[model samples]
Target: MKFICCGNKGSMPVNDNGIPMDTKKETEAGEPKYGLGVRHWQTFLYFFALTVAYAQRVNLSVAVVAMTDAAAANINFPEYDWPEKTKSLLLSSFFWGYVITQVPSGQLARKFGGKITLLTGLSICSVLNILTPLFADWGGWQLVCALRVVEGLCQGVVFPSIHTLISTWVPPNERPVLGTCAYTGNQFGTIVMLATSGLLASSSAGWPSIFYISGGVGCVWSVFFFIWGASSPAEYKRISPEERKMIELAQASESTSEHPKEKLHTPWLSFFTSPAFLALIIAHSANNWGFWTLLTEIPSYMKNVLGKDIKSNALLSALPYFAMFCMSFVFSAIATLLNKRNCISTVVSRKLFNSLGLWVPMCALIGLAYVDADQSNLAVILLTVTVGFNGACYLGFQINHIDLSPNFAGILMGITNCVGNIMSIIAPLLVGFIVTNEQDVEQWRIVFFIAAAIYLVGNGLFIIFGRASVQPWNDPPAKHRRNSTPQVESQH
Candidate 1:
């Protein structure tokens, strides 16, 4: 196979004998040009979908703050008298539904198609988001909690669908960068949602406007998503034959058929018993413990511990996510470079990136605990850098699912995400008990220490046990031997 000239993070012209070119100097140049690759378009649109998904998911946190404000009385909005416990319930309600749908969504994505599964999820969420304010006012916090749970049910299929589609479409060489493009939307979306929710709520349109805005954008994006989204390269209408052949080469599948073979069975027992999969669950759960702890409490900490005003707190709290989003692309490129150059195996690269993602944040948590109110600037920077490093997770366990089981990527994502969502739930409840007085800095230190410890243990187990090679059960038809998944390019 011959290679063509490439751009940053871009695919090179490919023939049967080779994969995409090295991305070392390429990523430095920027997004690689893929003129007729619908794969690139799909990745970009998936990023937008996830951004809208998170915006709908998190707009409530900021909106709820303004929801209880009498300052909005001049507008049509009414202040609600919600107890702390009720407010907590409202905030935590989404995960109740989120945790339940993972396995089912994974199965559905396989049985049906990712494009349909994702669109269905997003459609349900956007409608719920639009109706949230009206329901919250009419039925009160109870209704709001119920609605959030429903929204979670709708949104739960998102990542699994994305994973399934990626397994079908993304070339192995560009998977890290393209996958990061989609997944990093989590950080980028949260940052935008938190930053803008208040501004929308404070406007004459009031708290209701944030919901309206998020829901409206979601609805619009859904239309585009349904039209442009394809289950596989074979299904994509506009992709050039050159790009389609590249996709075929990337998968190295014996069949060049347009449609993926339908496989109805999920290897649930095999998955549960796998040490490698279990290791991922541990790592994913631990990452969520730290991430969710910071996500749920950062604004509160900014308000209570550091005594920052609302605007300052919002922007400062958002800084970490902003840093995280920007850092995602850089490390994704590095992971691709490392693997492309044969410097390390894919498994080693996952561990290395996962270590950087987990351990740096762990250390940052420890450092943050020592930074008092007098050192608030350092505290903010610590938090920013911590989350920035967290973005390396895209190159870690996040994409490891595809490596472990391209045929079952959706299932793995769902199962691992289930574990993480449960951890996300538990972390908040654990933190609630730890920080009896939110104003107490010492108590918060204990919380940070607990998160760091979780990271320490989880990363340790993963390094010891995680497997990046495809599992034996993934493709019954293929004759690949155990632990013999061929990589895109050999380092040697």
Candidate 2:
């Protein structure tokens, strides 16, 4: 995230590259002293959308426990006799569809603009969430798995579209603060859903209410975002001239084209060959493996090993994510302040934060693996600290895509996320294979050790090879440039 300083030329300001800036001074333009800009509003909307989207995704995780084991929840509202294997299949099934569309979703965001693409996907997923309970009851676990697949397909577009939007709306200088803030919605959403889902499952309305409430909120949010959201500063109708120009200049130092919306070819070969990108893929995949392992299985751990009822399980599970949410702000602010003051280079900062995030969790998981069954409080505290420190990752490989290539941040994210989510699909299935007895602490120890080892190996590779500087492929020579500008125009 590089900062751009511009010099004034008469009423207009010019960037170092000799590009004329069209933004006005707010004082001269009679704008208010302080107010939320269009970008800020866009960030808020994005944050909430992520919140609802994640709640919809993970609601099934908690609900499934109540659905399968009524005694664990201390409620009996039509429980099913699902085997552990079947439950695992149902849990991982979402990622089966999720990974398939990642690359294509990036292309969609590039073609149609992120606003429409994101809104359409979120709207469809919301509707699917609303229909989930009925489908589960009618078709059983198999049908529920199928429905989750479709929901996953729709949600596959989310992160890529968000990357597209952030690259366009937020400048490099603001990336750490605004980008991390936007993504913290992930932890916040998880905390909200996890904390409430157990109570919902145990209430009179039963597990069905979880889906109904989340889906309804998502639908309402979709309508509002559709009415107000803009794909980029150029597309925003309500932006003041000064703010718009500031964003444009901020991007001018990074984007190759005069108009970033111009259609450009994706450098697939470079992406695959680059050590930096490959390192990012490794880190992303490793994080997903550990993250999803805990995400899908911790509830069972609480019920089986710690003897917690469903309500207590949900609340305790949410504590780690709450820590994650709070620490995200802290981590991002620290990164921003350090970078602003030039305390470290971008690559070093990336590695340092990433190491802290992954390494601390690795240590915690090792300790978690050895916890006695009676020390449930210690287990909860370890898990909380593990997730809390993991928030530093949002400032690491997560934002490195934008640093590497602002032009193709969406595509880079898509590729890594696609590969990364494969781990999400695999982690649960492997857990099903390894931890056959959910109550056996020793079997769970194997799971923790494997996750920690992967964390160690993955971060080691990233520290050795990961890069944060812009890639040469982001702007090829004029002779090699392939612009389908007219294609985008004609289609739109």
User: Considering every candidate listed, which one attains the maximal TM-score?
Assistant: 2
Error of 1 at 193 (Å): 0.8
TM values, all candidates: 0.87, 0.91
Write model 1 residue lDDT over 1-492, tens digit each, in one string. Answer: 111223444455432323232222323448344433467678888899899998887777667666775463224678899754555577778888998898899888978889999999998899899999789878999899999999989888998999989888887666777888889879878998878766676677877888898999999998998777788878865566667877877686523333344632456788899899999999999998898888877877887788775567677878899999988878877776666568898788889999999999999999998988778899899999888999988888888898788878998999999989998777777776778777899999998999999999999999999988878766544323456536611211
lDDT of 1: 0.80
**What lDDT score belongs to each candidate, Candidate 1 first?**
0.80, 0.86
Q: Candidate 1 regions off by >4 Å? A: 1-36, 69-76, 254-261, 477-492
TM-score for candidate 1, residues paired by index: 0.87
Worst 10 residues of 2 by lDDT: 1-10
**Candidate 2 Cα outliers beyond 4 Å, as residue runs:** 1-35, 74-76, 257-261, 477-492
Tens digits of lDDT, candidate 2, 181-259: 7898898789999999999888888888989999999999999898778899889765777889778877887866543
